[model samples]
Target: MTNSTRCGECILPDSLPGVNLDKDGTCNYCRDFARKEDRNPHLSADERLRRLERLVAPYRKRGREYDCLVPVSGGKDSMLVLYAACRLLHLRVLAYNFDNGFQSARARENIQAAVKTLGVDLITYKPNEKLLDQLFKLFLTRTGEFCTPCNLIIQAAAYRIASQNGIPLILSGGSSRVFGGIQGVSQSKYADRAYFKNVLQGHVDFREAKRFVVENPWKRAVRRYTRTGPNLVDVLDYVYPGLEQTRDLLEKELGWRPTSDELEHGDCVLNPLKDYLQNRKWGYSEVTQSYSSLVRTKQMTREEALDHAEEEETRQPPAVLESFLNRIGMSREEFEQTKHRHFTEFPNYPQSRWYRMGKKAVALMRKVV
Candidate 1:
């Protein structure tokens, strides 16, 4: 709670809860063996297991029912979360993934393995690649960040499925604290439709985003699928599981094994770019942003987070940058210049927030090159 209390190892501020400052101004969260205890008391792993059991008991009684709908990417967290829902809680889980066109073959393989081995029903919604490419271009060139629609598309694909099936809960990994720190607890449950709508309203209309999509490949596909239906897409407040509980299920039930690469950091392919962007623009990586709050909350240590941060810069391959640049029809020089031009030339407004976000994202891309 004291601003003077800094983590002994990492750069986390003292404002974070559970941060124990030593004589060196370093907090306990920066040291080895980070403990979880803070202003809010979360259930322990064993207790979490019991709570999960109680939560899923009603659905388990319904027979062969998916007690929770999980949005997965076949990453470590996804694998871990899916395993927890099925084996730990003894509830059937419907594994959901919205393929945004950047998945690696290994990720796909892992996803298939989790679904097959766990005996959970799997549902996938893929945005057309052509549409995805176009959207990415617009996001990259026009908006600069993925912005609301891209986030919506991913959430919408899963929620549409949840709504149609009357699934009451959609389970996800982690919390908002994973991003903007404890003080910025703005993100509610990703499954809450009302919350999603309120956040979306802060941006632009779903119709505008859809207009961009319809003008692209997804529109063509949607036309083929028949458009007559109520809007099933929404955010809901399904359960949010913790890291410790997530790990136990992954280790015990799913027989999940981490690849050598995943032992340090993220299990997703998108992270390299995500890290690069955050670092270049925000002077931080997602891990820094993520674990900053975790340290305050006592869910993780500063040393553990810094260990992950060490891997961030090395993960981006030279070929990936070349490919990204080529795919966007811009060389590294052009990309850098274009980014600079946008920041200097673009008119500023509340509507232009996406442009600013994109600038931040682009700054990362420029730094990596």
Candidate 2:
């Protein structure tokens, strides 16, 4: 298993959990997508732009101080979303960020540069230091991974701020075709707020983590059923130009640069730690998964993906993983014992009703969308 058997059509490797290659060497994921490919009719660039305009116009007419909320992590994707919210759509934009205390300094610099250059108001939210460390330790013990809470809570915080301020939209720069799951299927990674609630209910007090979390399952259901909340839109599905074209645009627009190697997971300081742990637990690399996604979409050739996969696999685990353990009061030995554990390994993981419902809701949304 030193090297993974990859799909012929895409870079997806058989090492990914649940990935299977047929005799023809095409992975199940590629086959599944082929069956559903026609579900999404290819929209012309012009028509996509037109759809975007109509979608945001009603939100813009609500007479809010800011027409939309864009979460900026100082990554090119989020920065581009901020750029589009301001320069492309000519909307008054507000930017939101949450620092879990592990974000890279380069990312911080990019955020400042983007907000200053774009002339948008910004909010930086930080969770309570003591409780955050506790959650980190808890997650590592339960799940081999620890990035889920950050993903969920950031969106939760965004929704909270949007609800309080009457902001009508949240535009995230996410694309399903980019850096998708290793199995080539996009599934939530125990990262929804409902899962956050499932993790925290008996362990951490609601009042203690009040500033950083919100867990109202009934309200969430109502909002979903009524469809009466700030419409969160992924700008990539609508306005994406291309990879190089976006990079070039951000460089010219906000003096942005890739913070990491080949624009993989440069946004977070702990990304290398993530790669190391997940590779050990799941027998795959995030870099390979992303490159495979590029190959899957025909954005990059298989030869190119293979070359980068080899290069990416040679990367050593970063020094930050050890320091991160120290910060969370975990010794190297404790980490070694715990790092391979998956969330599902715990007794009654994801036991909450809403979290189960939320997972189904994600699948349903994908079908109609």
Candidate 3:
């Protein structure tokens, strides 16, 4: 099949689901950001700092220990958040890392350096490696992707740790404005335990399925109902220096070293395989999404973003791919069969009446908030 069309202004290709191009050859995302920019003024760094201070002042020294839990992957974004919390906002912070056994050596070093230099406490949580391997194999064979468990565990562990420690806030480095609008599939439909179990019902034993899927409904309820339940906030929404400025700050202030790979994907060794599969399935990868964001923000010219995206799109690390397959006990034939399988064929969360009601309740809560 031939490739889909691309945005005239950015590297966002027309292959993305639900994306539309206007008569001017710009995609909806670029047009939306442009419209918002015309309607509202961008917040200055000083204004961001003032707003952050006001939001954080009441929480300062409220608990006996740290004021917030900052999840770090030693990526530039997380490093900036850690620096802002300790140096800029002057809040006592606890840095948390969830090691999924795929972290690169440089990422580990960066995490260690950030915590040591900032003088914040560090906590690393490692999941059961055997169970993780089984889940990865199952997902790769059944669902065509294997990051669902990793993402779910990271979020749940962060919230659970915060609740257990009496910390009321969990500061994450994720930002919708900087890292949004790129997903090909609906994550909420498949990125939860309910969907996971739906897929694994017959493939694996019930006990193994119970161990692999890590969603605790009681914990979720406690987090929602209790006053001390951790509140997750994105640091970037308040204090977003452009990407270039943030990189410069990391190098100058924190002695961070840049990697040849994209920093946003972190140090996962399995990312190349995932990106390759994404390219095969949707004709684009996370690099396209990230560089498109940079182009829209005017941090990088479209030409530069296109160059970077092209390089990422074509390159495949054979050794990493082979190692990942071996670790997950997936043979080459299985890998090929899984890669060719259509993404929609995979089992996902059913859109039942209860699910629809839950979505409406969430929307109402958002409006009230």
Per-prediction TM-score: 0.62, 0.88, 0.89
Estimate candidate 3's alpha-carbon lDDT, on a 0 to 1 scale. 0.76
Candidate 3 has a TM-score of 0.89
> What would you estimate as the lDDT of candidate 1?
0.51
Misplaced by over 4 Å in model 3 are: 38-41, 185-190, 204-222, 225-228, 262-266, 314-317, 342-350, 361-369
The models' CA-based lDDT, in order, is: 0.51, 0.76, 0.76
C-alpha root-mean-square deviation, each candidate: 11.5, 3.5, 2.8
lDDT of 3 by residue, 92-117 (tens): 89899989999978788888877888
Clashing pairs in 3: none
lDDT, candidate 2, equals 0.76
Which regions of candidate 2 are displaced past 4 Å?
1-3, 182-188, 210-218, 225-228, 346-369
In the range 155-194, model 2's lDDT, one tens digit per residue, is 7789988877788788997786675664222224435544
Clashes of 3: 0
Better of 1 and 2 by TM-score: 2
By lDDT, the better pick of 1 and 2 is 2
TM-score: the better of candidates 2 and 3: 3
